[model samples]
Target: MKVEQIYTKCLAQGAYYIFSEGEAAIIDPLRETQPYIEKLEQDRAKLKYIFETHFHADFVSGHLDLSEKTGASIIYGPTAQPDFEAIIAEDNQIFEIGKIKIKVLHTPGHTLESATYLLIDENGKESAIFSGDTLFLGDVGRPDLAQKATNLTQEELAGMLYDSLYNKIIPLPDDITVYPAHGAGSACGKNMQKETIDTLGNQKRTNYALNQPDKEHFVVAVLDGLTPPPKYFGMNVSMNKKGYKSFHEVIKESYRALSPEQFENLATTESIVILDTREANVFKDGFIPNSINIGLKGSFAPWVGSILVNVQTPILLVCDKDTEREAITRLSRVGFDNVWGFLEDGIQSWKEAGKDLDKINRITAEEFAEEFTPDAVVVDVRKPSEYATEHVEGAYLKPLSDFEEWVKTVDKDKPFYIHCAGGYRSMIAASILKYNGITDFKEVDGGFGQIKKTKVPTTDFVCPSKL
Candidate 1:
């Protein structure tokens, strides 16, 4: 028997592949089906089932396309009301794949239809549990995401999560491996560990969510410090539940190459957004005027989804020649399917065509330190928690995730400095600021990481409650 965890670092998501005796099963696949199809061909195994823990809110699932191509039955836990055909397995129901068995453990509260799949090896010993969002290595799924759909308050959902963990999951064998759907950097859980896999016994002892004394404590602890989820979450969930355009179709339509003049015309004539997906350093040097920069090297999809909240927004790409396909694919993963086309031959083509170019003013951390003034306006684009930990004493806390809303209040005439934990998010903020015509600001290169190393005064780490 072989079990593999296919981890995508940018999304911080894991999809599992289990094989035994020439039969294979896939759990929580991504939007593309070609990779899985290739895996099956390589192993010479026939896929029998595709398991979904719940309707995912982060990225569209490939269950429909995978099942259609392979004739595999798509399985979901009880209470799933998908528009497409799927077998809704009952709690404790078991399915066979060659010599191994997969038992369904209905564990809702991440969503009403969440479940964990327990793998019973050929030896009939419980071996591993694919603990979806129901349980993470150091934290459990946030309960607030399902509130509107279920008409349940977050507290009530948190209570249900507590019961799901205590009654359904905690009783599992200590030595059994725990494979979760997401790791750190995912919005699904606030405090997930960086490690993707852990032993159940270790989690029981080390995970704060698993060690809660009672359900009340568990609910309170899990709900604490959760920022609002990205606006694109519900749209992705809807697409997952109701099915979407095939991944192949999205790529085929969006991969069209546009000349510099055509790309410029599209941006001027249509209500389209220009998304530049080069690296932050490359993008800051030169880019299309008024384009938003969410670099492909960083958390590209999530940042795109957060800033461009509407999935249906029309977009034109300005990417490195090699990254155009990847830009479109990643955008489609987050339900951004209205991508029109990409600038052919990248920024060089635009330059050759004598198109107007825009650039951001950036300064080194040491330069910022020398120029620092007690009353100078400084904007910190890191998250709330990071700011609470330690930030420049009087820096304005305008987090990059909430850039759209806070950007409206920027004083275009006033000059300020902006920074994030590192340079990635601050560059994104800088591009957005430039796009909005707020150009009097300079972005601090190396961000707070380098700023903290300088003589600039920063607040000592303060307890969150005191802030």
Candidate 2:
């Protein structure tokens, strides 16, 4: 038997592939389907089933495309009614794959359809359970996301979660391994561990949610500090449930390459967004006017999902040569598949053509401290938690997730100094600010990380004094 956890770090998501005796199963695949298809071909196995934990809100699942491509049956747990055809499995149902059996344990409350798949080895020993959002290593999936679907309050879902964990998961043997769907960075759970895979015994001991005082306290603990999910989450969930365009079709439609003039013409004609996927430093030096710089080097998909609320928003790319496909793929992973084309030959071609360009003013943290004045406006573009923990004195919080809304309050005529924990987010902020006609601002070179190291006054709650 062979089992592999196919982890994608950018989304902090994990998909599983299990195979034995020429039969294979895929659990919660991403939007891209080629990798899974190729895996089966390489393993000399046939895909028999595609298991979906629930209607995911973080990213689009590849279940539909994989089913259509490989003729595999898609399976979901009880209470799931997808727009596409799928087997609505029962609470204790079991399916055979090769030499092993996959027992479906209906573990709802992450969503009513959430299921944990127990892999029983050929010898009939329980090997591992793929505990999809129902149970994370140190946390559990948030209860709020299910309110819209079940018309049940988060508290009700949390109660259901309590029952599910106690009855379905906690009763399992301690020796079995637990592989959860997401890790720390994911919005699915409030306090997930960085580790994706852990043993059931260790989790019972270490996980806060697993050792709650009671169901009432568990509900309160889990529901306490969940920030609003990204603007694209609901849209992605709808796409997952109602069905979406094929990944192949999205790729085919998005692969067009246009010359600089043609790209400019299309951008102007359609009023489509220009997304520059270059390094933050390169983007800051010079970029296409009004293009939003979300570097491909970081958590590109989640950032795009946060800033661009509409998944179907038409986008044009100004990416480095040969990187267009990657940018398009990452965008598609987050359900943004309407990429019209990319700038051919990169920004150099446009530069050579004498096209107009825009640049953001940036300064090193030390330099910013030296040039600082009493009334100078400073913006901390990190999350509220980050800012509240510690930030430069007098820096107003403007988290990048809600850049569009928070930025409205910034004076149109006055310049502001903006920074994130590091340079990446601030560069993204600068690009968006430029796009929205708020260009008179400077980006702190290394963000608060460097600013805190300088003599600049930084504090939490109330700033005490300038260092």
* TM of each candidate vs. truth: 0.98, 0.96
Q: Give candidate 2's error at residue 465 in angstroms.
A: 26
Clashing pairs in 1: none
Write down the lDDT of every candidate, Cα atoms only.
Answer: 0.93, 0.90
Which segments of model 2 are wrong by more than 4 Å? 460-467
Model 1, runs deviating above 4 Å: 462-467
Pick out the ten consecutive residues of candidate 2 with the lowest summed lDDT: 458-467
lDDT of 1 by residue, 341-416 (tens): 9999999999999988999888999999999999999999999888988999899999888887888988788899
- For model 2, how does the per-residue alpha-carbon lDDT over 137-241 read when each residue is reduced to its tens digit? 899999889898789999999999999998989999999999899998898886788898999999999988889989998998888767888889999989999
* Sequence-dependent TM-score of model 1: 0.98
The total of clashing pairs for model 1 equals: 0
